[model samples]
Target: MSDEGEMTGGEDRPLDWANEPHMSSVDTIMWRGDTDRRMRGTICMLEIYDCSPDWDRLVAAHEWGSRMAPRFRQRVVDSPLGAGTPSWAVDPDFDLHYHLRRIKLGGDGSMRELLVTCEQLAMTALDAARPPWEGTLIEGLPDGKAAYFLKAHHALTDGLGAIIGLAQLHSPTREHNPGKPQPPSPDPVNIGPLDLIGRQIGDEIGRIPHRVDLALKGVRALTNPRKALSSALRYGRSVPRVAGLVSPPGSPLLAHRSLSWRFSAFEVPFTDLKAAATAVNASINDIYLAGLIGGFRIYHEKMGSPVDTIPVAIPISVRRPEDPAGGNRIAVGRLAGPVGIADPFERVLTIREQVRLARHEPAVDIFNTLGSVMAWLPGTMLMQFSGAASQNDLQASNVPGIPWDTYVAGAKVERMFPFGPLPGCAMMATMITHNGTACLGINSDGAAVTDLELFAECLIAGFGEVLALAADDGVEPGVLRRVE
Candidate 1:
């Protein structure tokens, strides 16, 4: 699903009209990660209340918003000879209606039905020929309510970038008015295979000087015995740390995976979570990881195979202030969750300490640096590397979101659930805070995570255990709420 926002510095300024934007190295990796059966896409589900939005107004709003973000009207143009990274070219045949769809729920229009519909949409891969996004308006909910499901390719944006794009389509108040229609999008240029290869070769040749300069600097450093010794010492010390960044030994039960996916969602009160974190002297992220550990432990025990620990990949956002708003700037850090620890408080404390030390390790910097290089590799090699990187049991991420209540085209948005890609992992759990509540969306590989319903119940029970820990700190248990 996609939202509307411009690249940094593109707002209010006229389009270059001379050159198309180049996909970043990180984005290129995401693009290559997409396969025919398994598409790496991010789905955002927003439940709106009161009434359905006017179709015409919503379309116009999207049009206006897309004008601000030209990437919405562009498609990735890969180099014909695999000479360089892909480029973003304007899609001359871009159709607003094709990307924006409307569907009506049958019968009572229960939330379960809505989610099922969303699951189908999520499973269907986005068309690579056009822009990599589609927004669906789901109508016919109880009490005149409706929902919007926005699906965007992972190559287009990360979690934070998705939030920023969505903000452009919403308003602080219902009285806001959408402005006039914008000008037409630019036409795409047609470049033949020979031209594409020439352009790519030229680009690579242009980098020769920079490469030689770096090589000379490296030679100079090696000539200095003291500097070379220091560098060798640093490398030797970081060898183990770099190895630790890869997946650790995990439960064999969740080792097998399939292309199929199952999405589960639940809500927890933010205040209760904050209290629990405070009681343990940890961050909200620590509490989140702790809860997952507890849940996984319970799940394994129920399956008659309790494990000691599980490795989880945590995405660390490395976005800088000057980075554009709608591209990826994230690195993965693997952590061994102490699920063997029976005490919830003790588990949280252990996780907090582990995360604190992991962040400071030189391995994380090395991992990020390698990630940039991996993006330029062949798609098959990158996929192999990604498969190895995602060998961990689960991936947990916490993306900060809009704090205030928001409205989309005059409809009140009650909840926002973010569904991240499973990415060969057993499960991908992501949480976002919206309007005083922590909304968690869990996307599990259906083949690996059998009995998703029971797993969801276990997650709720896990959070209950954490909230119980917070009770000693004077936080009321009643503040915690669960939605399955």
Candidate 2:
């Protein structure tokens, strides 16, 4: 969103990130839940470029970006006792040198080796004291190519918001634009833990009227007791499904969870994936889940630990066109993945129906509805209280990408991969279609996926099955390739 109170199609504007001083109840949980090391909420993005952007220009771009979007210069200050939501305050000790880093690969400098470095970087937790984000420029690839890695807390902004934030900072063309507007740095605000607690108190006090209004609604509904009772029962039945209190059959093989993380990359043509989805009369999301679930089926069969179904989790975006493009605006949706289904078309069909039902749950918005009350709970107990995603084997998300070409400093971005956090899940798979390719970044628990080689092969073959469906539509066969 622009500072002028409206969003321009593609013009420069202040981002709608961290605009508010206090964190929302939902973001508070995400930030505090880091108490459980296994449920780190770090999200990362890796972008490959045709060539290394000029170092001087790159630094200048970030400096300008920090001023335009002050959230980059802010840090999370929790309430005194972690009893409530935190506040976003400008860091008094902000230092660009600490957050921005540059490194060069030493080995053959293959994409595979680069990913290994990324995995190590991702495994290192960000300092909660400082602004919960960092960036690195990795040079020395096979050609003149380079890559950039950006990691931030999930409380900062979601995958979609990150792209929006990126679009504002990245240049539309390779050549430097001397006439770009410069925005002043946001004034520093001294916000401490005690102040945050008071802010939380004020927010809670502010919600009394809403609560009272809801209570009055209930009282009025009692006049039509039968209708009210039916609505209450329907919502009550859906609460478990939305909260993940109900778990589906699990795969014994992917049951383990650990602190160690490993990374794998894959890409498929967007056109082909969409075409295949259309061929099956399903949405792209269904096809994506089917391919992922199909891969699990192949992997389990190969590992001699076949299962009929496994619990799958996907984020159901609750973001609206009028909502601010910041933080998370999503709810969890669970599915009983049909791994037993041998046919790709059948798997897609089954997944499509399951997704439809999950979205239509009477209480699909339960989390957001009760986040205020839940946020009051101490951080230490949030893992158990929040019904952690640990019960699921896979957590996947699909985010719309920046459709046009973009450059940072002077280098044009080639492929953009997003690695989502593994909040107790065996794997977090995120797909973002950059340009025409759907770049899939999978962050797996090191112990859960013992055989990375086999896992990658199975995923490729699984996607191959789904992509074949497009052949009947006169679409060229799309090939899913493992990125190094």
Candidate 3:
């Protein structure tokens, strides 16, 4: 597939730093959740390949792209007394080199060594005072191929939003210019603590009329006794269901979590996964989750500690067509991982049904409603709530990515892997489909998942089990088989 039609001369566009973006309520929760070491930060990696571009040209391209998106040079500023959600402000001492790092691997520079470096990068926390993002250009691959690792705060943007922002710095073809550069932005105004507090209080006061209107609506609803009673009963019934969904039975082995993390990456043919899903009459996400459950089962069995189910958190994107590109616009969907199901096909069916029911449950709506109210909460209170909410055995996400060949600094993007935040979860497995391939990035807690190599092998075997359903003939699917 070619992205020629989607190509635009975005490089020439000037950035408007004056129009700064603020963190949404959902984003604020994620930001505050960083207080806990177990759920510290999130990072995403994009791997590019082929001819290596000149160092000067690569740095120039990044600088030009940064001018197009002011957020690249901005940092979060909290409101006084937690009166409002955090706002984005220009970083006075912003330096491109600080965020854009260039490193060269020694010798042959195998993928293992590169991944080791990436693990180190992932473990290190981003400097809070600066913009919450960094890009590392790693050179010296075996075949002169290069890879770029871009890491950013989860609070800045969700998976889809991050991909959209990255697309601005890439091209449909190698011989094209990146985003246009604009004049340097002016320094942001320095506001005193009292002044900031006063402004936030005033902003809160301005919403009095709207609050009163809502109160009146509540009173009117109460006047309709029958309607109010029915609504109350519905809410009352949903409480237990939501509570049950939140705290499901999980494996004891994966219960304990720590701050240490390990990263793993693998690629599978998108066509085979799609075919497997079609054959089983399930969505791609269903198959993916089934594979994860299978892997978890295998890992536990190998350790002589198997469990029936595992709690998994799935983030559902709620971004609308008219919504802006960045910030968090998502809700969580909890699933009871069917680890006990031995048959891959049956596992997929079970997952599809569970997910269908989860979507229909009122808990999802309640979760989204609470997400919108998180901005009004005090920082500490918000952190406590977020920390409790993020407790799950595992998290799986399927983010659709660029479906056509893309270029970054004249190099073809070989693969795109996304590593999401652990968020107190034992493991986080995220998949993104790029140019007909599904790339999976699995991040496991080092303290909880002790045997990394065995866990990785289990995951691979689990994926193979599902892929086997794609073949009509009675032939077992082996490791690394060609899908097409």
Best by lDDT: 2
Cα lDDT for residue 378, model 1?
A: 79
Best by TM-score: 2
Which 10-residue window in model 2 sums to the lowest lDDT? 1-10
Relative to the true structure, candidate 2 reaches a TM of 0.96
Instruction: Give the higher-TM-score candidate: 2 or 3.
Output: 2
After superposition on all C-alphas, the RMSD of every candidate to the true structure, in Å, is 3.6, 2.6, 3.6
Writing each residue's lDDT as its tens digit, candidate 3 over 305-393 gives 98888888787787887778877777677778888888998898989988887676655656455554556777677667667666678
Question: What is the TM-score of each predicted model, taking all chains together?
Answer: 0.89, 0.96, 0.90
TM-score of 3: 0.90
Whole-model lDDT values for every prediction: 0.73, 0.85, 0.74
Error of 2 at 438 (Å): 0.7
lDDT of 2 by residue, 1-484 (tens): 1111112243454566557677777888898878888888999999999999888888888877787688888988877776777888889888889999999987899989999999889989999989899999999998899999999999998888888788767777887776665667777778766677677888889999999999999999999999999999999998988777787856779877888889889999899899998887989899899999989999999999999998898999998988777788888888998999999988999999999999999988877889888888887777876546457889999999888788887788899999999887888999999988999999999888889899999999888888888887888768789998
Model 1 TM-score relative to the real fold: 0.89
Off by over 4 Å in 2: 1-13, 387-389
lDDT of 1 by residue, 374-462 (tens): 55577777677666656678889899877876776667778888888877778989899988888888888888889887787778777
By TM-score, highest first, what's the ranking? Answer: 2, 3, 1
How far is 225's C-alpha from truth in model 1 (Å)?
4.9
